[model samples]
Target: MSLRSTMHIPAVPAFLDSVRLRDIQLPLPAAPDPWHRLGKPQPCTASLKLSYSSAIAAAEKDDVSLSIDYGKLFRRLETDVREMAQHTSSPEHPHHRMVSVEGTRREEMKASAVGQDPRVTAGIVANCGLSLLDETAAGVRRMSHLRQSPRNSFSGSQAPPAPQPADAGPAPITAEYGRCEVWLQLPKALLRAEEGLKYRSVTVWGYNDEAGADALESESRSPVVLEEEFRIEGIRCYCILGVNSHERVEKQAVIISLGFEGPGQLAWGSTVVDTYVALTRAVAEKVDETTFQTVEALATFVARIVTVDFGNERVTVRVEKPSALPFVQRSGVEVTRTQAFFQSHEVAHSTLATRGEARSIEVLVGPASSLTLFRCPKQAALYPLEEPFIVQR
Candidate 1:
């Protein structure tokens, strides 16, 4: 006899493909040094997570040319950043060249009077991680704006451009009295890999002005602004969960990952610095005591803390169970919610966790079959209401 208990649980598509680049150093010029001093190129990190939208036809058909080479993507990012940094955003005072390491040559290349302009400096610095977005990878793959050389892009027979005069120098780039604060999330990337520039520039710059240099972005709009994207990856915790009797008594490991966007950039006029360590600590500690029965409740609780308690404008929370299924690697729920979303909807934050009782979200966990949300209202169109039905871990 067959195990006739498998429920027809409808779920989101699984086993999606993604290409990633982790810990790539982004050289930030005239930014704060490790010692808190200015006028140095502080090296920062950027990570990319590009997921496949279509059926990943290249992999299915066993075709090499149809696939996007990770190596080419890596090289393209490096080249585009270098080219962007080398050029001034404005056409009025153009002195496009690479920022070098030599001490004195940097000084000579800087124009004293103009080097003080924060707008010009921020524009150049922001461009390092900034790019436009499109609906498909074809948009980026076919663009010629970011060619190896601007002049030679048109024809191979063109003469090399003339050299600049000794007196002509690059614009002023100083991190002394001001800074160029921008947060472009590769996490900000959407479905398809489209755009010649290969990325989208959302203005996460802390600067008060919304119409700053980042506004120059063309094409599609980002899901959120470009202020700093905060994250706490690999949050491992043990919690009681499941429908089985053994699972009710024992605790199982759950993996959680969270991402958020902070408020506007404000210059902290102090010697010490602030960080997301507190936010991470707070979320982990609260989630540790959580005894939710389903990954859905756990994920929603995490999103609530980040958006309501931590004051983040928006948050994406993912909670996964490694032991939920016998053959499957993990079963999980991912939810994205905003501060405004919670304010208007009371049910968004009504699930309370107390020391007195055991509780789990009233969710449907049937397998590959019809789904019925026990507690969700018929009109609930909010994120977690009809959340991506069990996005695989």
Candidate 2:
């Protein structure tokens, strides 16, 4: 039937509508008793009463218009119910389609999502490890500022300071000097030699001064005045001789002195002597003119000695063979002297007379005539003068 016609059909209850009746007749059963099954047994009333209520109700209420309207409403309701079920169950409905589209779009969005770039974060971590920043947040801010700032602004400032020079001033002085007093013990064999044959005992009195003159000269805007003194005491040997006698021997005694010279030119009071008699002999041989020449030569020699280290200085030397007549059992002599700007502590035979022997010799060096002495014949006579110095052991 057409949908419109189905909607217009007369109403029928669902129970009654589902029931069906056969169109054909059935044969009757043979009677069992003669009393005859009177007329056909009353229709099965019990079945009719239990299962045919809708049909009975329909038969009792016969309003054609109302039935027709009810049938139309029921047909419409059924049609509406069927359509609702179809819509709820179908996979292609608008709601289901919309959900599928949404799910697919969500998956696509996830697949297209961009991963984070780690270059900037990695740079920040490295910078922090190097102590360039306290944390990642601060590092990021700093980088941002740096990117935005002008590059040339930081490059225009002044350069760092330079280091100072080393040789900018005069150096400090360290040289030193002094004088000394010494005693010497001698051997008799050494005293018997020509140079030693004049003394029985010997004494040494000397001074030393080292001014570090080089340093003073370098730093001083003006000239420097330097003075020094020394006192030294040590055991040594000497040869002694009588004032007039030629015989000599060795004796031990304390020697003392007031003036001493460095290895520089000999001063006016430094010398080596053994006897007054020998001193007299040496003096007697000198005429006034010869003595003058000798003195001048001696001065020149001293100057030569002193100037060996410093050219701008003068020195004086003296040799005195003091008489030993009263102090010793025999007669003898002692010698002493000084020098200025001396350069050495050693005494050489060549430093004294070229014809006499020296039992002991001392030298002073520097501005402070520091005194140094030698008692060994080989060392004291290093210059090998014709006269040898008597050095006992």
Q: In model 1, which runs have C-alpha deviations exceeding 4 angstroms?
A: 1-125, 128-229, 261-275, 340-350, 355-393
Query: Candidate 1, after superposition: displacement of residue 105 in Å?
Result: 31
lDDT of candidate 1 over 234-305, digit per residue (tens)? 666776655444465456888777754432222210000132334555666776665655677778777777
Off by over 4 Å in 2: 1-226, 231-236, 241-243, 246-323, 327-393
Q: What's the true lDDT of residue 322 in model 2?
A: 32
In terms of TM-score, the best-performing candidate is 1
The local distance difference test score of model 1 is 0.42
Tell me the lDDT of model 2 at 343: 41
Each prediction's whole-model lDDT (CA): 0.42, 0.23
Best by lDDT: 1
Cα miss at 301, model 2 (Å)? 12
Find the 10 residues in a row with the least total lDDT in model 1. 188-197
**Shift in Å, residue 386, candidate 2:** 29
Q: Write candidate 2's Cα lDDT for 1-393 as tens digits.
A: 001110111122234321221111211111011122322211110000011112232244452311112233233333422343343345343212111101211112112111111111111111112111112224334644554455634554544333335553221111111111111111111211122111111111111113233432221111010111111111122223222212122222212111233321112111221121232233222211111112333333333333332232333333222334456543222233223424453343244444233343443211223423433222323333222333222
Q: For residue 21, give model 1's deviation from the true position in Å.
A: 9.8
Q: Number of backbone collisions per candidate, in order?
A: 18, 56
